[model samples]
Target chain A: MSALLQLTGVTAFYGAIQALKGVDLVVNKGEIVTLIGSNGAGKSTLMMTICGNPRARNGQIVYDGEDITRLPTFEIMRRGLAQSPEGRRIFPRMSVHENLLMGAYGRPPAEASQDMEQVFTLFPRLKERMAQRGGTLSGGEQQMLAIGRALMSRPRLLLLDEPSLGLAPLVVKLIFGAIRELNRTTGLTVLLVEQNAFQALRLAHRGYVLVNGAITMAGPGAELLARPEIRAAYLEGAH
Target chain B: MVRDAGLSALVALGLFSSMIGVRMTQGDDGMTLTGRGGALAAVVAAVFVGRLIMLAWRARRPAGTPSPKRVDAGLSRIGRYVAPVFLIAAIALPLYGGRYFLDTGILVLTYIMLGWGLSIVVGLAGLLDLGYVAFYAVGAYSYALLSTTYHLGFWTTLPIAGVLAAIWGIILGFPVLRLRGDYLAIVTLAFGEIIRVVLLNWTSLTGGPNGITDIPRPTLFGLKFNASGDADTFATYFGLDYSVTQRFVFLYYVILGLALLTNWVSLRLRRLPLGRAWEALREDEIACRALGINVTITKLTAFAIGAMFGGFAGAFFATRQAFISPESFNFAESAMVLAIVVLGGMGSQLGVALAALVMIGGSELFRDFAEYRMLIFGIGLVVMMVVRPRGLVSGRTPSIFLGKRKDIAADLVAQGRG
Candidate 1:
């Protein structure tokens, strides 16, 4: 199958400092493409760049065969690209239900309720805390809510930034299980950025290893997991 | 502790200087500096005594009072009844109130309408608009000019004035689209001053500082309130004795109806999609954009709608007085309305009205205090701020919820985050 999203030599900057330099990445349809990296390796930058926040100063971003390199962030979001941003930036004052409604802001109200039900079915914990304020949730629950809120959009492509960050082992497992289930059941295309290298590679269909601002390696998930260089650099002692 | 006392002494000195030392007079000596040494000493003594009392109080109190759980959930339970009670009392005011009370009621209602209008822009949309009086001015002038030049009645000019102010609101909203917070405030303040200056300089059109007088008063469905030989005088038509107080009562009901309409519209809009989007934008603009909300349009609609209401209040102000003047729409007027919104809990309609009654009505109550009234008002405001930093009735009920609608603690919401 053809690629769902294609990025060619995408370079992004924060003022004069370059965060993403000459990055080329692709995610095929119905596949979970994991990008594993250490701290400050441009993972979040790439995700934001795709959403046209800090717009790609050079090169192109193609999503579903359309060049969305210069579109506004809301326009990109309207085109079925949703991101559960780093640090779980949920509206703290808003309730979990309101946050979910915010996610489906671009969609029809009728379809949004159905999407909400699907999200609740995936994350039952969120359903229980539907009335709770987003800020009042635990880190793991907030992470779940962030993901669930993004899913409320029913996007064709989901960009998750550090979903496993600061989560307990069991909560991490639950989150990964949810991601896998979403991919398997709905054929959802996912571009996951993770610092938890081993679990990410094991879960992804294909994997790319990013160091500094560039991707150094790309292969099948199992092959990347087996590579000694990746094993020592990222997966070592990171069960 | 000694350093803290010294700092407090300095603050007391500064406060006394502003409050008592300097005065402006309209004489050969335009400004005068009076050395109120006794007042300064008194202020310093008061501060030191206050500090000592606070220290002693803290020392006597238990160490672990559990931080007083700033969230008074019970207060909101009581607060739910405040609006209904106040509404009932306000409706019955004309039956038993004297002329002075009725006038104060009209004044309080006008401020409440203005407060509600500003609340939409500042409180709901998170846009600090310091020059909201510009819209009020626009509305007042629109009605004033329409009535004087075109001989349009109050009813005919009301909607026209509102639309005209809304258009001006849109015009002012454009340049400030990229501005936020303090920057937005400065621009809006400048816009308000610009309107006042234009009115002052445009003598032919606006009558300059002399203002437009003898503007027609509102009639009750084409029936004049006078006993004069008009086609249908209200007193003659109804076969009642013509009393000047009847006009004041009619004006009271007119403003009460207008204020109620403002309240109803604002409360209804708060639950709509646009209002939710506004709150979202206030919370996080980037997140709002990510959610595909058009932030610019949201902000503009808030401005337009807010200005529309301000216009309605201004038109009513003109009709009530049957006169209009630039002096009536000064920066102090803007500050007064903004104070009402802030002193009322932001985003709470009931709070705004309550604040208006207290601030405006309370000022009227202290009118006998003469020059000391402002000092008392200032002290009262400081005390209120210290007691309830988030204004009275700060608890927020979420616009949308799934299960039971619990009141979100005022302390829980990050101020200026939304």
Candidate 2:
């Protein structure tokens, strides 16, 4: 598979501190790529910069061969890129259906509705609670709604930041299972950011280990799974 | 005639008649029209009358329906919304009331237009504006100068006023695009005060403190409303009395039409992509920027469009008054208009209009309590805010289409509240 999304030498900063330092990553078309790291490892930071949140102070992001380093988040989203932000920044005041629709703000109406059907099929729990407010939903359901909302944009690349971060085993299983099913059926390219390295690597084709602000280890999911150090730090304690 | 229809009708009629003399001092032109204060009084009065009748009728036989209590409850619920309805009716009062009254109507319409105008910026976009009156002055002065110098008619000056306001809006929008919440509010307040001060001090072009008077009034076709209607003097030849009231009423409707047009346009723009962009900006500006919505363009459009309406209202004020003064466009006007929308309910079209009506209308109602009139409004505003933090019609929504909502009342109380 050719590269669908590429981030090279990406650097970012908050008011004074540097967060990302020359991070390089790639997710090929139709592949599930994961970024596994401990807390504050710049995984989420990299995800945001790719989507133009903190903005890349340096380096480049290319989506479908077009440089998108400085493009605003909405524009990147318009070009078939969507993110289910960490902590599920779903619009809390809105209803479940409205939150889902918020994701499709860039999609054409007919296409968005079609994608809505697919999201519903992927996580049927959301369908049952569509009328409930985003704030009222349980944690697992919120994550599912977040993922579903992102997909409403009919994104060419779906970026999920910690889908299993705070979810129960069943919910984690359900979300990961849905992610795999999406890749299998739609050939969607994914860039997942997770602290739950075990589940992430298990589901991903490959992943990059972010230590501090740099990439330390990169290999196939199985290879990363075998690393004693990686196992002890994250996966061993996590479900 | 609503449920318990028979009893409520008598009460409404009683209200409708007694309220006629409520204005007391009939202006040489006629009665004063709506303002936020005036609108509130009308609401209270209407409810008092309607409730009294409702109680009597209910005691006699209650609305002859299965859920009679619900119907009565619904009447009270609706009765509470007297401000919005009274304000809407006030928009048309200038037509029949006479010249002085029509002029007051013009004032009401000016605010109605301003409230709606700012609603787009502050309400929908969730931006707090203190400088909104600056745009009003811009449009007013633009209309005044353009009219007096160019000898342009009211219709002719309107577009110029709108364009000028929009241009200023763009200029104002850019500086504050980076700001949000209280910071945005302070910046906007400063912007409005700057405009007012500039107009006050800029003696050369603005005509400064004296302000431009004798701004031409609108004409029907080419015919002026002046009595010299000798063909050259259109008013005399028409066989109708050359009453200034006619001119005032006509102008009142013109503003009404324009105000209605403003409502229609905003409603349409809201449904389009731009409107959605504004909402996104409101919810989360950072996220909106990420979605590729140019923060600058969205912010600028809101300012420009909102200012354009302010300009329209300002221009109308100039023509209707036949005089323009700097005092007319002040920070107080801005505050009053903003208070109307916020009190009405942000992003609520009907709510904003009601706010303007109550605010403007209630002030007029206190014509009897002239000494304490302002205090009444100030206190009323405070009390209203405390009682209803969201607004008078808090959390009201727009239908995707323009039709009343369907009702299969969920509870008897809900039906009554309806």
Candidate 3:
């Protein structure tokens, strides 16, 4: 598989403190890539860096054969990268419909409705709460709406940061299943950041283990799942 | 109930003792202090009676018959019909009311327009702008300068003034792009003061504090609303008797048209994509960026559009007064306009008009009670904040809805920090 997004020696910082320490990662076209780490290991920082916010202080980020290391967040997003950010950053006052419309902001209106339909197909609960304010949605429903909103952009590379972060096991299973199904059916490229390492490894085609802002392990999902350290460190007490 | 009333009267006595009981009057000998026992007793008695009536009213009402939320909802529901009815009364005012009433109408409409203009920035876009008067000054000065320097007519200078103010909005927008909440307000407040100071100090161009006078009034397609005897005069052209009230009536309608246009455009803009982008920006800036919206452009547009309307109102003011000065566009004007927006409930256009009517028109009625007007206004605002923190029309009708239209209660909506 050809690499859709390639990051080399990527480092990011908040003032003097470094969040990403010379990390190298690759997300191939039509492949589900998972980045697993414990809290504060720069999993989210990595995702945000690729989106050009707090940007890569030193390194190269090539997305779809174009350098986007210094591009503005909105510009990078316009280049077919959509992020369902951590904590589900939905517009609380806006309706579900308006939130979806915002995701499809720069796209053609005619195509947006069709894209929205595809998102609704993935998460039907969103359609029921279409007129409801985004803030009023339950945690799981908000997660669904966040993913649905990201899908409205018809992005080539879907970057989901901790989709199952606070959800119940069943809802987590449902969300993971949707991501896996979407990848298989549409060949949609995904770079998922997760603290739920076991579920993530089981769902992803390949996985990277991050510890202390550096990748400690990289291999196929099943191969990583079988590693003793991976099982002990991430999956020991996690269901 | 008697206990509550007694407690209220006691508190009232403590509050009003020095204010009502004691007075200082300039007599032939000098300033003299005197006691007004009767006045103090009357005030205390009035407070006692007021508390008793309030307690009785509350006791008589059934429990939860009208929740605050229900009241807010009902008010907004009635607010729907209030607009057209108010418009009819406003349009018909010149027919029945004398010059005093018409003049008050003009003042009220001016504020209504200003309130609606600032609402776009503070309400929809969620940017707290404290220097809105900068644009107003820019507009007024633009018209005054053009009319005096280039002999441009009011009709010709109006759009020019608006464009100039919008440009100033953009100018102010660029520097404060990253500032939010209190920081943004401070910078905007500084910007307003800077504009006023410039107008005050620029002796050569702006005539300094002396101000520019003889700004011409608006004419109806080159026909002047002046005394009859000349063919170009409106009275002569129409073959009607000339009356000074005719000019006042014409100015009244001019501002009415301008204010209504401001309302119409603002209403239409709310339904557009640009408008939605603004509200989204207000709701969450980070989310807006993640959604690929150019935050810079959105913020600039809100400022520009809001400033444009302020500019329109300013130009109308200059033409109506036939004079322009920095004093007219001061911090107080900005505060008054912002207060109207807040009191009207942010983002609700009709709420703004009602607020302006009460604030400006009500203030005019209280002209005789100048000393107490501001005190009463302050108390009214405090009461409003405690009773209805979200203003009169707190619920928002979603610009776009699916299945059926529903008003999002104030609790669900996020009021941006601004």
Candidate 4:
């Protein structure tokens, strides 16, 4: 399988403090790759760096076939990389439909509507709250809208940052099931960052353990889930 | 409830004590102080009564009913009818009202255009622009210079002035691209002062502090409003009396047409893709960038389009007065326009119009109050802020809605901080 996104020796910093320290990772096409890490382990930083926000201090980020390390955030996004960022930063003032339209920002209206229909099919709850402002939606519904909004872009590579951050277990299960189903049916490449290691490892085809801005272990999902170290560090005392 | 009212009255007394209670007049003795005990008592009593009424009103409401949202919706429903009635009244004003009324109408309409123009930046796009009068000055100067030097007609200079202001808007936009919130407001405020200072000092070109005079008045399709009653004059060509009121009426219609065009364009833009990008940028800049929208271009367009309208209004001001000056585009003018946008609902077009009427027309009516006009205006604004902090019409109508359309509650809509 070809690598959809390859980050080699990527480094990022917030002022003087380094967040991503020479991190190397790869996400192949048509695969669900999970990066499980504790809080402040540079998971969100890696996601933001991939989108060219803080500007990686070193290393190359190649997405699809082109190098996007030096590109602006919007330029990188225009190349079909969509991020359902941390905290589901949806447009609070806009309605759910308008928020989805914002996701399909640069696309032709006809194509956008078509993709929006596909999104609605995936998250029908969004259809019910079509006219409601995004801020008024419940947490689960907001997560669905955020993912659905990402899907509206028709992206080849979807970057999700902490989808199950503050969700109920049942809601987490529902959201994970949708992600798994999406990957299976459409061959959509996903790079999911999550603290829910057990479920992320279960849903992902492959998994990487991020420890303090560096990838310490990488292997097939079942192998990582079975490893004593990963189980102790990320999966201990949790279902 | 009485305790709360007493506490508020105490705070008001503390605030207004020095401002109202003591008066230092230029007496025979140097700055003799006098006490206005009666006025101070009246102010404190009024505050006490107003606080009591507000607390009583809140207590009267049932808990958790969301009555404010319903009231907002009702107000907006009434707002729909108000726009048409106001427009009709404006159209018919010249027929019955004398010169003073027509003049006030002209003044109010100019501000409505100015308020609407600033609304696109501060209201919709969420960019705080205290330097908006800079663009107005640009437009005014463009028309003044173009008409004086090249001998251009008002018809010719109008578009030129708008384009020039838009260009200046883009220029101002580039510097503040990374600024937000208070930083943006301060930068824009400085920009206004910079333009005024430049216009004041650039004596060779702008005529310095004395300002430009004898700027040509706008003609009606090349027909001059001359009392000579020559064949080419409006009086002779239209077979009418050459009253000065004819020119005033013509100028009135000119601003009305321009103001309507501004309103039409602003309303239409709220639906367009560029406009959507602006609202989206205002909602969340990070989300907008993630969606592949070029924020630079989005911000620049908001500025350019907003400034373009300011320019149109400025051009009108110059033509109407037949004089242009740096004094006209001061920081107070910028603050006044910003006040209209804020006092109205930021993004609501009709709210801006109503706000302009209250601010400009109400002040005109209060001209009889002489020195106390501004004091009354300040008190009214303070009361408005205390009662309705969001705005007069704060509920937002969603640009696109599905199912039964409903207005978004004011609290749900995020004001663009920058």
Among the numbered candidates, top DockQ falls to 4
Chain A structural similarity (TM-score) per candidate? 0.98, 0.97, 0.99, 0.99
Give residue A209's lDDT in candidate 2 (0 to 100).
98
Give the docking tier of candidate 1. acceptable
Task: For candidate 3, write residues B1-418 as lDDT tens digits.
Answer: 9999999999999999999899999999999999999999999999999889877877886654433767877887898899899999999999999999999999999999999999999999999999999999999999999999999999999999999999999999999999999999999999999999999999999999989999988999888988846999889999999998989999999999999999988888888878999999999998888888899999999999999999999999999888888899889999999999998888999889988998999989999999999988998898777556887677777887544323322222333211
Which of the two candidates, 1 or 3, achieves a greater lDDT against the reference? 3
Docking class of 3: acceptable
Question: Which lDDT value does model 4 have at B70?
Answer: 77
Tens digit per residue, CA lDDT, model 2, B72-93: 4554477568646765676647
Model 1 ranges off by over 4 Å: B1-40, B56-71, B403-418
Clashing pairs in 1: none
> How well is each residue in B185-278 modelled by candidate 4, as lDDT tens digits?
9999999999999999999999999999999989988899978878878988989888999999999999999999999999899987778888
Give the poorly placed runs of model 4, Cα more than 4 Å off: B4-40, B62-67, B402-418
- Lowest lDDT sum, 10 consecutive residues, model 2 chain A, at A90-99
In angstroms, give how far residue A238 of model 1 lies from its true place: 3.5
Residue B21 error, candidate 2, Å? 40
Docking class of 2: incorrect
Q: Compared with the real two-chain complex, what DockQ does model 3 have?
A: 0.46
Model 1, span A45-126: residue lDDT tens: 9999999989999999999999999998878888898888888888888788888888888578899999988997788777
Docking class of 4: medium
